[model samples]
Target: MTTGSVNPRRADTRRNHERILIAAAESLAGSGEVSFNAIAKHAGVGVGTVYRHFPTPEALILAVYRREVRHLVEVVPALLAEHPPEQAFRVWTTDHLAHYMMTKRGLATALRSASATGGDLPANAYEAMVGAVATLLKANVEAGTVRAELEPETVLRGLGGLLYLDSADEWRKQAAALADLLWRGMCTHRD
Candidate 1:
């Protein structure tokens, strides 16, 4: 019974919210216009539970986008810690490309809805993404593994075309090849 202690019920509620977001993301990945009932069923929760967590589809979409962005931003440091700068950057970028491919459909729809409202959606998603990659790039530059002049935003912008690829199965293969190309272009020396 300490002040500022976590409440079990509140923790459970937060867990449920995250579960709902994950389910919604999965549902939206295939078709951007998935029904709330489908998302609720996917999450193994009642429709009322979903509504309690997200009052509107826009709210759910916004939350999903924010969560996805947060995951990308948060994983960078851990990736760098576990791998060489170049390897970490490649792995992170590859993961990002895959994530974009998986979520592109729903994310596009969500972004349009959120933007139409001019709501609390974080508009700095690119900035956050580039910043994370920049950290890895900086480390590689310092290590002489990558070019010192490479700009994180420029690299990200260059990879933007991958998002428009027509096939999901091909996305993974093409993304890997693109990552290899990027790695070669950025490296100080060819192995």
Candidate 2:
């Protein structure tokens, strides 16, 4: 029972937990709803497993929301390392940020509907998002791709349009256009 030792059962439990969260997030994004049965089936786990991991729809939704926000914050460093600063900023905005914004709207509605559990999602998402944007902005500034004075808060405000994107519509195109518009403003000089 040592904490440092890798227990196979614990590892399997972690895997199942991640799988359930991914499945639940996808379900909420695609359908704006949560079905434990469907999530269990999609995650390839028994329904009882899902129930054990998340006793209520509200708990599952909150966990999914937290996982997504964590991903958004965590992915920035990898994106910066993988691409040039400008490309990293663009890709993070158009890919991770956009998808998360769209999914977030769905999660909100689902949370409201799942009133029985009464679990409140955390309020620090704004600060987390601002931190992510700040990291991206700093990289771009260091690379001389954007103005050094550009504020992360302002840039994030500009991206607020993403939250309104209707997944049923041309959201990807709209997201790209919005990001492009913001990028132009953020750039120190046109390429």
Candidate achieving the largest TM-score: 2
Q: In candidate 1, what are the lDDT values of residues 1-191, reduced to their tens digit?
A: 67997899999888889889888888777677657899888888899999999898888888888888888889989998999887887787777655655686667867787779865778798899888878888989988998889989888876676676545466667777878887888889987
Clashing pairs in 2: none
> Which candidate's lDDT is highest?
2
Query: Residue 29 error for model 2, in Å?
Result: 0.7
Output the TM-score of candidate 1.
Answer: 0.90
Candidate 2 colliding pairs, count = 0
Every candidate's lDDT: 0.80, 0.90
Every model's TM-score: 0.90, 0.90
lDDT of 2 by residue, 1-191 (tens): 56898789999999999999999988888888999999999999999999999998888998999999999999999999999998998889889988988788879887776654667666898899999999999998889889999889999999988998888899889998999999998899986
Q: What are the runs in model 1 whose C-alpha is more than 4 Å off?
A: 3-5, 165-167
Off by over 4 Å in 2: 1-5, 113-117
